[model samples]
Target: MSARVPRVLAIAGTDPTGGAGQHADLKSIAAMGGYGMSAVTALVAQNTEGVRSVHVPPADFLTAQLDAVSDDVEIDAVKIGMLGSVPVIEAVAGWLGRHRPPVVVLDPVMVATSGGRLLEPDAEDALRAVLGLADLVTPNLQELAVLAGDALASSWEEALAQGHRVAREHGTLVLVKGGHLAGDRTPDALVGPESPEPLVAFDGARVPTDNSHGTGCSLSSALATLQVRHGDWARSLRIARGWLRGALERSAELEVGHGSGPVHHFHHVQEALETWGTVPERFSDELWEVSAPVRREIEELEFVRRLGDGGLEPERFLAYLDQDLQYLDGYSRALAALAARAPAEEARSFFAAGAVSCTETEAQLHRARLRHAGLEGAGAPAGEVTRRYTTFLLAATAAEPYPVGLAAVLPCYWVYADVGRHLQELARRSDAAAHPYADWLATYADEGFQEATRTARRLLDQAARDAGPAVRERMREVFLEACALERDFFAAPAAASRLPGVVAIEYS
Candidate 1:
């Protein structure tokens, strides 16, 4: 069955400018994969510059809007924002008490960026009552000070103290934002009633952008929506903060208002849409099909055909193993580079493990085989083709993005595994008791190597899916080049044997 989308309701004031209030909340909710709904408590006349005025709707009408939504749809989460008066706050608190949505994130929109008061002086106490009903409370330094009945916190330490006090008193989680603090770093913490210390603290370099309007509203709504999906407060906060940072970094791309403009809420969504429009559904299948000629050449090579029938000379086979040892050294380094540059944890771990396996397991296999052939001490230099292939792989991983690097190295895994399986099948059909090079053939055709190749394909396919048109084109170029290089690598041993002064080295 398909997963159900979270239905999140934003009960807040309206910003026709779409930078803050319910508009920002709705955008954030949708961006985090939730179905968004909003009920306006106030019609706010505001722009990036500042708020001109706020019109509070009648308490009964606000209640009616809230009831209309809860009566029909099941709300998974709610983000409460900008209640202009006591009656409005009480009305919201009343509805919340009755229905009690699974998750409630209250963004205490008390003070604006321009230092204007959004909540009435008399309504502070009422807003506190709503805090008890919320699962999480997001408050800036000014609102935090007001809730704790203390002076404005001049430092992060003072802010945490206020957050702890508020959380302890109300028995709710408080998200303390340090953007108002003076520093190169903007820190945030999730403080709960159970502990004096914050449950989790995130330290991030402040994004240098003037278009950070409605960050608090956006963050709170994102937290509410993400909570429904993850069901873990710390995980939700981590994802929400990362998304907000991306939005802040991309905010400059937008030209919403003259003053501090709204952040680019759909930055990731827009990129994903662009990728979906351009890239094919099965990108790896296309890569394989495009490189069919190269694979056919590899299968037709004299070395591969002779090796499959167990008639290839031992000196030539040892020469190939020697070249592969040199190639694996550089290949492992390239894998390490990919690991360091990977964006996701799973991809990073996969590439890191591949690097380790290449240097240890695969290298040991080559060393043992060469030792058994009585050429253990022979130190033959890499052939021209081997040097060229390794150099190309190293350059791609060092200089290009993750996608391009991934494409350049993929052929080594895919082509080797394909050739290994084909040769294994040929050996199986032969009348001989066993293929002389059965061990080597089985190494590449085994379940472990095949699974690893499949994983590499999956990673490249995902990278292609997320990449832009220009990046995908670069990926295709590198992939085809690497495939051609694989064919040359297979033919290198025979070519080297025929060259002048190429005497086979032997152990004493």
Candidate 2:
């Protein structure tokens, strides 16, 4: 999972109704867990009913706003909407060419939802030129036709063709939306420059609502933010579409104006805060509850159950131990990196101690176990799962913020403690003295390790409290990702045991 909170800038017009343009862009950016900034190109006196008038700011002033943000902050992504005129469009294009933010999503806003023209007639060619600079272009059917220099598409196939043409001509991704078509299902396709056909398509049920006032602006901004967060176009599109769909489904709840109203931008966030409360005390509980399925899956693994019952083959057990030793080497380094970045002395001490424990204490235990099993000089290469998990940890610790690194490493301590306790109880219920993995279970389930887990949980909760909404969201995402990787680590040995001709594991 990507760790940092993306800083996204929206250069667009504004709606006093807060349903479209920069207002909607900022809302979508925040809803998608990004720090949002804005530079207004035009201020429109508009409502859900229609645009009364638009006041364009001078292009130089717009440039000033963009410069102010870029000079101070490192922009991770940019969302462009409603440029209004050729000069304003050129001003934005110039800034984009200069800064070249990592991701750029352009929403070609030609006409408003209430049938008001927002862009000047002579600016169509300029908007086309701007399309070449964007990473992704989100254009509704009407806007797509205008940019393609073709008639309005009456069918989905026609729309996709136009999308491909624009993508091919501009060398960028085009998001073609089907909301303007007459249908029960609303489909959206992502057309890329490399293919004549759409690279991906999402078919969703038409949401029954009249309050989808700024869906284009909202979705474009969401794409910009999510692209920065995930760094995969398909995954970003899927997440962005899911979020927009939810907002659209709940749009009528706002009831803001007489005509079409704004979608409820904070619907999911509101629900999450209500359930978890404003305090950080419930954060750990939330992580545990959300990861209950993974915990259950770990308990049900064939390797775990067999080990608890003294039925796992000796060769497989040794292989698992070898993988664990290899994993710990990388894990210890990640822990030391976290200690180096920790703000408080207590946290630094705790993580530093953990690194020492991983390298010295765990290493001794694994070596002693291997020597007892008559494999004193044997060690296996790290398997695919082990390599991937350790690489993720090292990358998170080295590249992400301190809080994000903390979240990434917390699952290793917490999940092991929980699973250890369960295994110890299972061994106790059924002949603990005969259980082959009794020593390993006791090591993880011991009171000292349990205390360490509690301490880590406490530190993470405090970190979440200190972080803003965007960073907190990022921490949660990283935690969940780490939990899934933990489950995969436990499952790998069992999966390997099922393969043919794999009776005796090889050691180097």
Candidate 3:
């Protein structure tokens, strides 16, 4: 017999557009790997833009719906959203008092994204009272302000302050969302009275998009599902936030409506179809195949080609080498983290050796090259590209599971080996001139490097083979992203030198 999955129920209103309310909650719950059930409190006549009207179900019927779900089904978690009126909030609150689920996430959905009021003004008191039943409450700045009985938060600090007040007053955990803040990064924090600082904080680089209509609903529901699945709030929040960020990043690809569209919950599935055309029979064999474009771009780079034939400028080569050393600092940390998280002793030892190689072997190679170039004790500062790439790698290793983290760091070893071998072959065909980059090319083409690359591939393949479909798909995404970043890393010096004045703006 199959094991039972966590059953998550959403007690919320309906959005006909399917972008918010019960629709979004159910979609989010299922997307986060839960069996979702819903008890509708109201029917919202709305689209992606805003709500036009809401039709409230009778308090007694809402109670009946709650009883119907609790009577037969065992609910692992519950997400409560958009209590339309005092009667409805009271009914749901009363139900919560009796049938207390293991996890209760209340999304205090008051003001909509488009500045429409979702709950009645009088129901604010009822909502406040309802918070006692919730283990966690997710509230954006506006909702947080209302819950705190304060004006709209003018800053992120104010929002966090409001969240603390509400959490302390209700004796519940509060997730303060910073998406509404006008900034490049969206930071969320989990606050409770048990700690002076936030219990947990997830800082995310904001995906600049208008398709954030149902983000509040989705986050709360996803947290509920993940809570049921993992039973750890911090870990669940990290995974949920990662999934949400990915959804927001790809939301623009969806053309749901003219207004702010709903987030693409299944973007990963759509992406695989768009990218691979037909799903590869084996992801392991086709890993490098999928990265063909990046490899081609790297091969065609002027600096790369010139280095192969010993025609690259010494200054440019020195700059690349210095930036590489800076990158190694972060890379070494990522490798060490991967080693610590590896399930098998083989993987653990391999990644641990990799970490040592970066700090010791690679460091010696870089210092020798810099000294040969008459640049001893002189190093180039970390460029924007190097920082961005290394930052992504470090974050991936820290936030993701061992398998996902392994996928992220694999491309650096494999891609460099492939590029080095190609360059080494090109250098061999050319006349035996004393090339400035000869040592660099030789190191990459070395048998030890090749062996390391092979080991990386084997580890990734084993992990992918053992992982479930969802994790395997995540591995594909991290692999693809890391490969793309590897190409960017190779082409960084050229891009920066070529476009000295022009800034490159990357969204994801």
Candidate 4:
């Protein structure tokens, strides 16, 4: 009855301590929603105390494991943790070239929590051999220093410098985790030229806890999940960091291993499973009723048929968009929150794309605002319109869907595309001489708006294709609700009730 999910594979050393390596990666992956597969490089003998010994797997055995996973299951993305030995590293590197999964996330685990070396001294060369093949490589302060070679990371500035260097040198993005930096906020820098500026700094509230045994593995695995599911770097890093923070917060009180404890990977899932038949997601009946009304209007309206006729108009369309953009911005923020709560990489990436989508829509709305001609007053609409839209956003923000929370944003995209096309006849016939009227044509006529609309259509199509029929249906309901709200706002029954002019502000 549940939907099919993305698949992810994790390859790395095993930390029996459960704090730092492949175990952390797998746990992070599953918490996100993707089916998880794994290949072991080595085994660690340790607990909450320290690593006593390590049993490095044979290079041939490592190959067989990688082959077994990649040969059988469809691995959407991959996260690599510690290799433990030169042979292990080489084995993984060789398989990486052969499989070439969509995304490869690497956590360059050269050192451990107790200041021990998980990688052999000569293993650095082997690690570098495969570093360039990754989509991303995550490194902490010490590992970064080692990977960058001797003189490259003598100071914090040098460490930051090496992060950029690593990405450029390897043709792979690098996430330089700055949790070790003495600061009030823990910041991790996502570096790659394809992204904005020098880096996208992901900041998280620093939780003072020593249970961070497998943090490197956890973070990289989380990022890999996002990259695999969403294909966005900045979004992935942002979500991955948030998920790791949540695990740290919740697992702070848990004590399992003697050395470093594992995160509470299934906290939310376990809670729900415990409460399973007794209590479903809150307000189930209400969701059905609230969702149904919008669907009814959509079914009755021939929106999709009109879109096929190419008769869609612009100004009226733009009016609905301003509110929708506002809504998307809030949805993106919610995705960020959901990502924070992710227990695994696959789950984090799911929301990561939503965040990217949020900003993408916001950008279009910003461009549309320029057409509003000056802070020139256009007469205010009713207070209720503003209140309603704001209320919708606030409600989503407070919801607990977490990574899956991105689902809330789906309604706007699919519904609008469906409804807009249907109103093509109205769009062409409507008078363009009025206030919102002139604004609508101007907004839709612009190249940016056209492109934005196309993107929304494409994204929604992708979602429909990827999501299960049930989830798709839910998304459709949400989209219909948004369309209904737009209709209500634009088709205000009383023309005399129109308030004062709205002053349009220029975009910066």
lDDT of each: 0.88, 0.88, 0.84, 0.62
Model 3: lowest-lDDT 10 consecutive positions? 499-508
Model 1: how far is 153 from its true place, Å? 0.6
TM-score, candidate 4, is: 0.53
Number of backbone collisions per candidate, in order? 0, 0, 0, 32
Q: Candidate 1: which stretches are off by over 4 Å?
A: 1-3, 277-508
Question: Candidate 3 residues 1-508, lDDT tens each?
Answer: 1135779999998888888889999989888878999999988888877788889978999999999999999999999998979999989888988999999999988878866788999888888887878999998887888889999998887888888898888999999999888888899999995653788887877898999989999999999998877778888899889999988989888788878888988765675565444445456677777778888989998878888888876656666777788888889999998998999999999999999999998977787876765665225456777888888888888888888999899889888888898898889877856776787788888898899988988888777766667877788888889888787777776643421222341211
Which candidate order results from sorting by lDDT in descending order?
1, 2, 3, 4
True lDDT of residue 504, candidate 4: 32
lDDT of 3 at 425: 82
**Model 4 lDDT per residue over 1-508, tens place:** 1244657888877776566677777788877776777888888776667768888867999899889887788788888887878778778878887888888888888878766678888878888878898878888877777777755354556666778777777887888787676666677887773532446776667887767777777777877777766677888777777677878778855667655576776665665566443432322233335656665555454432232233333332333344345545555776567566555565566556657866875545554563453322222332365447545544543462321233344444444443444444455665543333433334445455455445534444443444454665555455445556644544432122322233231110
How far residue 443's Cα lies from its native spot in candidate 2, in Å, is 31
Pick out the ten consecutive residues of candidate 1 with the lowest summed lDDT: 499-508
Instruction: Give candidate 4's error at residue 29 in angstroms.
Output: 0.5
lDDT of 2 by residue, 1-508 (tens): 5689999999989999899999999999999999999999999999999999999989999999999999999999999999999999999989988999999999999999888999999999999988999999999999999999999999999999999999999999999999898878899999998886889999989999888799899999999999998988889989988888889888887879999899988888877676456655757887888889889989998878877776788777777787888899999999999999999999999999999999899878888887777665226667788888899899888888888999899999999898887877778877646677777778987898899999999998877777767777778888888888888888777754321233555432
The whole-model C-alpha lDDT of candidate 2 against the native structure comes to 0.88
Q: In model 4, which runs have C-alpha deviations exceeding 4 angstroms?
A: 1-4, 150-156, 193-197, 270-277, 280-508
Q: What is the lDDT of candidate 3?
A: 0.84
Could you give the candidate ranking by TM-score, starting with the highest? Answer: 2, 1, 3, 4
